[model samples]
Target: MALYITDECINCDVCEPECPNGAISQGEEYYRIDPNLCTECVGHFNTSQCVEVCPVDCILPDPDHRETKDQLQRKYLALSGQATAV
Candidate 1:
């Protein structure tokens, strides 16, 4: 599943640079994750970098965007231009 930032986020900006997929970005008041770009770092890292570096522990799974490992891989491929989003 894609990871998302919660309202509890402090906007410390720690999570942004740690994301391998570049999915994390600054929002109006907090950091946000682009579900279409987030792969939980499957293709780039062994685990979610944002979650690892999140000081506020506000990052959590997006239940609405649940996806399997293979699906996450496909999403990574699609975003990186290895394949198209089908």
Candidate 2:
């Protein structure tokens, strides 16, 4: 599943650089994650880096954008330019 930053985010600026997909960005009030670009760090790391570094634990899976592990892998490959998104 894609991850999203919640209202609980403290904007500590830790999660931004941790995102390998560049999916995290500063929003008007807080940071936001672009679901289309978020692969939960599938191909980049064993675990989500943003989640690891987030001080407030505001990052959480997006229930609306549920995806399987294989789907996340495909997205990671596509994002890395190793393959085209199907």
- Top of the candidates by lDDT: 2
Q: What is the per-residue lDDT of model 2 for residues 1-86, given as tens digits with 9 covering 90 to 100?
A: 99999999888999999899999999999999999999999999999999999989999999999999999999999889999645
Off by over 4 Å in 2: 84-86
Worst 10 residues of 2 by lDDT: 77-86
Taking all chains together, the TM-score of candidate 2 against the true structure is 0.95
**lDDT, candidate 1, at 37:** 89
Candidate 1 structure quality by residue, lDDT tens digits, 1-86: 88888999998989989988888889999889999889999999898988888887999999999999999998888888899545
TM-score of 1: 0.92
Model 1 lDDT at residue 54: 82
* lDDT score of residue 66 within candidate 1: 98
Q: What is the C-alpha lDDT of each candidate?
A: 0.90, 0.95
